[model samples]
Target: MTTTLTRPGALAASGHPLVRPQAARHLTDEQIAELGVELDAIRDDILAKRGATDAAYIRRVIKVQRGLEFAGRGALLFGRNKAAWIAGTTMLSFAKILENMEIGHNVLHGQWDWMRDPDIHSTTWEWDFVTPARSWQHTHNDLHHRWTNVVGKDRDVGYNLLRMDADQPWKPFNLGNPLYNAMLAPVFEWGIALYDLELPEYNEGLKSKADLKRDLKAVGIKAVKQFTKDYAATPAVAMLTGSGKQALYGTLVANAVRNVWAHAVIFCGHFPDGTDTFTEENVEGETRGDWYVRQMIGSANISGSKLMHLMTGNLSHQVEHHCFPDLPSNRYAEVAVRVREICLRYGLPYTTGPLPKQVASTWAKVFKLALPGKGHFRKGKPASA
Candidate 1:
């Protein structure tokens, strides 16, 4: 949750405060309006270009994913050679990652809404993940975006597992073994499914029993379909062709690869050094510009080549993505340059680094924050409802 280089009170060398002071009180109206205008210009420019090229890009990515998936599964089902199986599984893994990231995540974010394709829109496009699209949209798009890294508000802080912040009360089980973090990456989707259920909230009387039952039924139906597709039906079909074992193993490997990659990329975005977390008091009366500032500070960027960007769903520009979630993701890179300039203009922190550095710094925070310590940025008392 906090940044690198241990200092008693400072977050980074800049010593920038984690959450901006209450923006309405600290910022001049003119300054806030200037930021709003600059960001809007960037969004407007990207919006104007979201036509043929963008459409072609999404359609092409989907086509490649489909082709790879078919070829991969075909090899797994019909081929007996071990090398063929490995190739098939690798292809399948890439296919799943592309589907989940470039296709599923963006489409469900309404990134392609300008296409006017009803089927591909956020309202109807479900994902391959066990968490139902509607539920995920509510939790992720609505809640997570609305409360990026506000410790008590965003359920994503440590995902209700590890203690991400020093202020978060440490329970006996808070001291999880490193293996616990390791195990989570491969089965990240399952962890998300359980988190989405909000069962713990239901138990704590935060969510009603009736709503819990409804959400549970929805999750159960989606989980059944996902499990059957990867674990049962494909293997069964391959068994009829005498390649059942290979098919099953291939599917398992593919799923694990997809899950771990997604987990790693997502963790890199939020938990790394330089990213900030807020308290309820700081966000009170937050304006549009204030929200943008919060997101900018709370998200970190991973720098890499275009292929790495594609693999990360262009979340390498996490700050830009958080700023403009509904924009065609391809435009994030273009807008990122403008965003960084805006940060410099406003004297805001621009936090970014290579993917390896980002990931290592994030995991180090995960390990360091796991044990007891004075929580970073714990001064603001949580605002009342």
Candidate 2:
């Protein structure tokens, strides 16, 4: 199914303030309300069906991830050998990816909270990333998710660093967007840790000095633990086995691979060519339906095999994730189908593409926005299934 933009008021009649006459397809307020109801039903249906299968799926993935990490570390002890180094690095890379993406990310989202298990619960699950879990939840789940792509409202728009949207005032610092992003990718976890600190908020007097100090302390603790585990403790053990340097390098490369992959996946989700950025005024009087519409238009998806989807924590279904973020990641594939159908019926855009294409499009936008200009990237066309 496909949809296209219509002229302002071409199909709308409900004069709802939330209805953007300039939208890709003009939906009447009544239609938007109906869309919201359908989406709500999808959420309800998934919640109802959540059961032992979902529980088992998460448990199985966790077991595999743990086993891979154990084996990778074991292999690193023999890393003085060329084959051992390659094997350990490869396994460790996959381990870190699985842990960060499939397990840690979803667990932190509270996807398994329904089970009432404290071990895998969102409040207790500290992810492998450098950012403290609580800080990330505050900035990400609380702020970024609520704001999505609203220019100044969502800090994730450019993480307060890059000129991602033309609406974002251009500064001389923005000319370094490409370079900043290049550096950010390999150290993405570190970047996220710094971003979660919300330094800009502190500087602007929105955050209190005491709170910033507390958050900084938490980040310091988390960073120290991560560094010790990856760079110190593991390598120290391998040192006793005469493979200290090899083990250190293996962990270093594995972390870099995970960071780069994570950066790419996340960038593909929200910064791609077709995804829209909103203004604060656009969400001033937002309703349930309006919020759904915003998420649908503000995010893009990656189309690929199930493996690719799993690796991305099912964020390949970026549109669906933005809509029903608390739902289990394992269910996003099914949710995406219903969501796409809804988009077709309502003449909304469902922006999606392969990973490479999305990455190129996102980077292109970064470069384009870096220069001083009023030109905005063209709105995304509806993706065909």
The models' CA-based lDDT, in order, is 0.80, 0.85
Write candidate 1's Cα lDDT for 265-296 as tens digits: 99999888777777865665565676777778
Q: Write the per-residue lDDT of candidate 2 for residues 146-192, one digit (tens) a residue.
A: 87887778989899888888877888899999999999999999999
Native-to-model Cα distance after best TM-score fit, residue 65 in candidate 2, in Å: 0.5
Would you estimate the TM-scores of all the predictions?
A: 0.90, 0.93
- Candidate 2's C-alpha lDDT? 0.85
TM-score between model 2 and native: 0.93
Best TM-score among the predictions, by candidate number = 2
Model 1 ranges with Cα > 4 A deviation: 1-29, 375-385
* Model 2 error, position 165 (Å): 0.5
